[model samples]
Target chain A: MNHRVLLLALLLLALPSWAVIETYQFDTDLQRQRYNAFIEELRCPKCQNQNLSGSDSAISQDLRRQLHAMIMAGKSDIEITQYMVDRYGDFILYRPRFNAATAVLWLLPVGLLLGGLAIWALMASRRTRRVPIQPLDDHDRAALDSLLSDEEKPSERSGGNS
Target chain B: MSRIKLFLPLIIFLVLVAIFFGVQRRVQTGDYSPTALPSALLNKPFPEFSLPTLQGESLSRAELPKQWLLVNVWATWCPTCHYEHPFLVELAERGVPILGVDYKDRREPALKWLAEKGDPYFATVFDEQGTLGLDLGVTGAPETYLVDAEGIVRFRYQGALDQKVWDEQFAPMLSSLEEASP
Candidate 1:
């Protein structure tokens, strides 16, 4: 009996997750899918963090109703999104449209990656490069001769040690 | 080049500091609020609506006068509405045309509220179902919209209206709007 009560309590806890229960009849499965997708993507204006599907705020519920009615009336996705944008501004959209303001947001990561790649290529190319061999210069040769003369040849030194 | 590279981090940190301080200043001054959305209907015509007045009379676009006015969204349930009531009353006394939208409010409580606190609105829109409020893109009660003489939505403010807000934000805009009109 305790186990059953606990199970029932757990089931009741799950009930709140399915907030705002309103039956929306769609002509086809695709239409229903579109409705789900739209609710997920559309932000609740009142509850800024929650989407239409997650929020039970008055505005969110109303928007869900409107979305369902629009779908039932066979409005295209663009038309429906545009309708939302017209009323709630771009803030309603979870993914903001590409515009002058949002261009920086979308392009910054890609730009940074390309910049990093260019620097990496430059560093890699630098690391792989070998200084072109120069024939011994007169000054270098003179210095080299002085240093060598100061020490016995390795062959002679090794032979003496043996 | 290496010396300049050394300062790159400092430069980036300075830029970040500048950006943060700029945002902080705006937030401190009450100029920036995350929840307040810029109205999509700015510079657009006021949305058309046919609804009943508090007096049981029909009101529509035809009834809106060809004069600049304020549309205030309020409800008896909203605490801020009570806070701003006196200021609205003052504005109305100063000959500012004010229209009230009783958003998602019961008729009895709303009527009682008006009776207890003097009604400042020239005409009160009975939006019990929140149809007009939804059309106006009202996120919550105590939102106000400034409509120009041409029926254009000039501005939408999301908060309780006060004297400071009036002088600092709305008054300058109102004067400019008045000057622009023939």
Candidate 2:
């Protein structure tokens, strides 16, 4: 047990030494969690489809440090996000704000779904409204019966001759 | 009415296609730099930071020139800054005061590069940690900001500065600022 504990401690110590660990001091666990979420929500401007937390680029690193400083300085979430947006535009945010430029992006899917439902409803209502064939009247029934009898009599006479 | 309705989506699609093609042509012709993110510091007061100059003297917003000046964010490691060096040298020789922000670069290499390439700046601030750069919203090197007499950022230009870019973008604003000053 003593040997196993020593080996485990050695492994843990060696693990951290080789890694480039980024440490940020937060006043509270809540603050640290907020910082993590904020960084994940921010897109790295220099990278392709990468959040600031995942990006190791120089700019992303600098931005992360700046964000840490701002959070430590007691800035609110709105203030921090606004500061980023003011510097990098709305492109920095993972969730883009609703604006004139992004209106179509937000509304197009809803519009398409409503349109499809409208078309489906129209087709269904038209199908229900279609007039089914009226039941045969008495006169038509009698005529159909006489026609059938006349055809049967000929067949019967042919059978007798055969 | 139903016929028109039936063609509405097709008409909308065609219009969208035309708009897309128009934008594509504009992009292909290099009318806009899509990768160049817009600077949000325009018309805002320059961020405050006191940094040491190459000669070990402190530099800050208070010491900035009262007249129009250019603050160029550059580094020795950035190749585009080297490409823009000659143009900056020319501008400096023509009496334009350019304050260089040596962004996240080593002091020795920065000094050596200036000595070799000819220093175009009135003074270069050494920003080794990039703290000042973060405050300035600088994501990359080779960005130039034109500060008005009052130290407000009037304009920002990203990428390498060439004669045409200077003539078209920077010059007009510089002249206007000069005219409005006195």
Best by TM-score: 1
After aligning candidate 1 to the native by TM-score, how far in Å is the CA of B182 from where it should be? 4.7
Model 1, B21-81: lDDT tens digits are 9999988888787778889899999999999989889899778999999999999999999
Worst 10 residues of 1 chain A by lDDT: A153-162
The lDDT per prediction is 0.90, 0.88
TM-score of 2: 0.73
Give the per-residue lDDT of model 1 (tens digit) for A1-162: 999999999999999776647878888999999999999999999986889988878778889988998999989999999988888888888998988867887899999999999999999888778565679888888887667756967665554422
Best by DockQ: 1
The predictions' CA RMSDs to the true structure, in order, are: 5.1, 8.2
CAPRI category for model 2:
acceptable
Give the C-alpha lDDT of model 2: 0.88
